[model samples]
Target: MASDPNTAPHLFDRALLRARMDRARRAGPVAFLLDRVVEDMADRLQAVTRGFSDVAEIGSPGELLPWPLADRFASITRVDLDESETLPLEPESLDLALSALALQFVNDLPGVLTQIRRALRPDGLLLAAMVGGDTLTELRQSFAAAEAECEGGVSPRVAPFADLRDIGGLLQRAGLALPVTDVDRVVVRYDSAFALMADLRRMGATNILIERRRIPTRRATMLRMAQIYAERFADPDGRIRATFDIIWLSGWAPHDSQPKPLRPGSAKSSLEAAVKRAPK
Candidate 1:
């Protein structure tokens, strides 16, 4: 059955609740991956400064902290849309900003990025990680197969994600400079679809597509979906793999730069010299 467009908000609420349940039930592996990324980020930040006097973490949900640096910083504040429509910080006051696995959920990403840029002091850095478009390929395929077998058609139900290629441009549009983005694909194998759904809940990553059906998903349909997922996507080892593409981004808040004329007595390097100087 096709989703009711009029019930977009209701569907989103239901999907959010389902995601919360999934996170509560299966959080171990997901937390493990999240922690590694946070630690890596924290280590880099620590190298730059002995401590930050003021820092804000957006959409953290009380998790994904690098606790080793907890004592190093003079103050740490957590910000979430659930708490406030606007960021709690004064404009251009934050020393650093960080987020992980959260940007994908925001409805107005550019607006949020603009807010982050506004909250940062000139040259302050923003680092964020979010799930990219290629996540959950196996689960999506299974869902499509189940719809085909039971309903004769599959209406789109998944939330769309930002592409890596376009992320840098978004940063530039938000008035952030020196943007960098990289993709990390993590493949996790599951013995059963039920277990996979459990993990998604624990990670607070249940689907919240605006056009999702409001009616309860029937047990029969769920089972059919699981079976189709296992049969079509399971590996020879009898486990199904879910691929999560995590995109990491870093950028500096905008700053004025003084342009200089070309050097009076310098010449461009030869193509051969440039090729030799590039990293092997």
Candidate 2:
């Protein structure tokens, strides 16, 4: 089914985004942020389990989930952003579906997630990460201030990121079993705000907001923004701080054999009695 146009805002230009990513790939390692995201995702995936018979990794680019996960899955199929948006998998065919630093751009996030749930075999798993939760607060603030000071207004520069509470709720709404979500926060240091922007460009993560300003930004305004960024977020060494929060979510497709939480009032021992039995 197509996404509801009334409620869903087209906030991103996805074709342009793909072009940006292609350019970034040609440039190579413009930003190390996604690399870190993929690395952490690999660790998380490894910690939970290993060795799946059939797996699909969606929306991961270049290096495709790091080298460590190569032999763990018997087969790994890669799907880009467009495929993930339209989830073209056979129902109940996949043993595992994984994505990294993606899915935040989808116009219909809930619908996409539900489709992913449907694609998984019963008891199959979905482990994914998206850049979110104050990921670029410093840059957002800097750009807003610069735009307001230079043009007396600010246009949308950073796409709004999803929150953990809403994300967990979405997992449940998608009918995922035993859903879990966690936020991983990391602070990276850059020599300057300009350097940070350069990296964002290389990452193909620069502003692709549909409502972004059409004209080029003024150099003087950009300089002022850089100054403000340094004054507000610079560290002891004068390097500016950038925050990236990778929200990780995982769930299993429902099956009769999987463990289920005890029903309310079905606990064998009471909390009060357990407390009483504890040593001082």
Candidate 3:
């Protein structure tokens, strides 16, 4: 059954929705900045394909085609889920699935993965990239301090991120085989912490926790956060640095007739010996 938006596990809060709307309004500049990263990921995915008759791109529209890789796709469908439980596609239909910087917002990551796996045909490939735990250290620290001063305690400002190991495990749990995961850290420098927040907002990435309680942040808290951010994580040139850890994951659906290497006894010599004797 499709989960209700209100009752869904990964519901985005009002503050987060407002943030995303604000970011969407300024998508022009944000898209420009993120173009390079999107293009790189697309290129990598393209290289792995022999040919794809059907492809599905989740999340950002601009990420799919900075210039126009759409021509290469046989049937390209874009899926964007905001406050929804199920993907808007049939099961076992897609040949290739790609998502860049999109999965972090999902409240039910495992459920979402199940949907993706179901959407792919036998042997279909899924490649995704999402922001991971080490992202926005400076901003998180500042927010923690602000919460400590303004509120009695701090609630998580940014949503929790999945680690590489966890992501691989998620793929396995979702019934995806040959799952591989890796991380890439992109360090961005800004004139101030405010600029960093502005960039994130422009990228349609802001707080969207559905369970978040309303607590107005004081101006003093903001200022203190900025001060701490600058002092603690500033570069020698006095600019603030924010690190975005991008996690890359790829997997294939299991198939009954999939080829397998010889078993231990099937080979004359040990597997290690066979590998050593094979051509370099």
Candidate 4:
């Protein structure tokens, strides 16, 4: 069950999460998924926005994009949470900021977005993608059932994900302009739930809740979760499926140049008149 929105404490252990990422960076196939999202972000940036002199890519994997497209920026700074501080970005120093699959783990996401807004110059853009929505539903459900049956209780096994509307609200609350949010759901087929869990481990996406049980999960619970997952989510071919919802968000630092919604009731035509005039 989810915690109260008003009273939920920061549950993630940042130190442990960083350690998981360091280990996952060694061998993570999930990087391919992020690579695709990066390509999409790059295309959108190049196609819609002006060329920026200073750009930063937070959480860049081992290699920077090796292509002319990346050279369009006069300078690009790659930052990783493990390598440097994730907060206190120099105020108004960046013209463009990119984050791929990194913001979800933040304990204070709204504050972080506000910081990003502060770090961006007028009209500077923040384009990012994070795991959200229904991500890991099968695993979460399976874990809950297995733990409830075996241990008489359930612990947090998956991180809670925000939906598109909530993220849009956050962007607006951060004083961003032209905020937009969308989602893409991707399902991957696996031989069993164990394979999916292994991939999550390799991706450094495992549970790292501070309130998580200190003792290791029981072996019986693990096996039961696997069985429940297969029984509930397997296809006709007997291969289980895992769901990942990627939420993409874009917002610009508040600037007068950006388009604004027209004032309420400013339209020349009345809504009732327009409806009556329409073909019936």
Per-prediction tally of clashes: 5, 0, 6, 0
In what order do the candidates fall by TM-score, top score first? 4, 2, 3, 1
Q: Give TM per candidate.
A: 0.80, 0.90, 0.84, 0.91
In candidate 1 the C-alpha lDDT for residue 26 amounts to 56
Better of 1 and 2 by lDDT: 2
What local lDDT score does residue 23 receive in model 3, on the 0 to 100 scale? Answer: 59
- Over 4 Å off, model 2: 1-7, 65-68, 268-280
Candidates sorted by lDDT, best first: 2, 4, 3, 1
lDDT of each: 0.74, 0.83, 0.77, 0.82
Scored by TM-score, the top model is: 4
Model 4 scores worst on lDDT over the 10 consecutive residues at: 1-10
Per-residue accuracy of model 1 over 51-145 as CA lDDT, tens digit each: 45678899764465557776666777888754123456688888788888777776556767888888888778888888886888778888888
lDDT of 2 by residue, 91-188 (tens): 89888999877788776788778888888899999998888889899999998998899889888888899989989989998889999999999898
The prediction achieving the highest lDDT against the true structure is: 2
The sequence of per-residue lDDT tens digits that candidate 4 reaches over residues 1-280 is: 1123345357678789878877887774467667677677767776874767788777644344566777778888886654223454788999998888888887767767777788899989998889999999999999999999999999988999989999999998888899999997889999988888888888888988888788899999999999999899999999999999999999999888888898998989999999999999
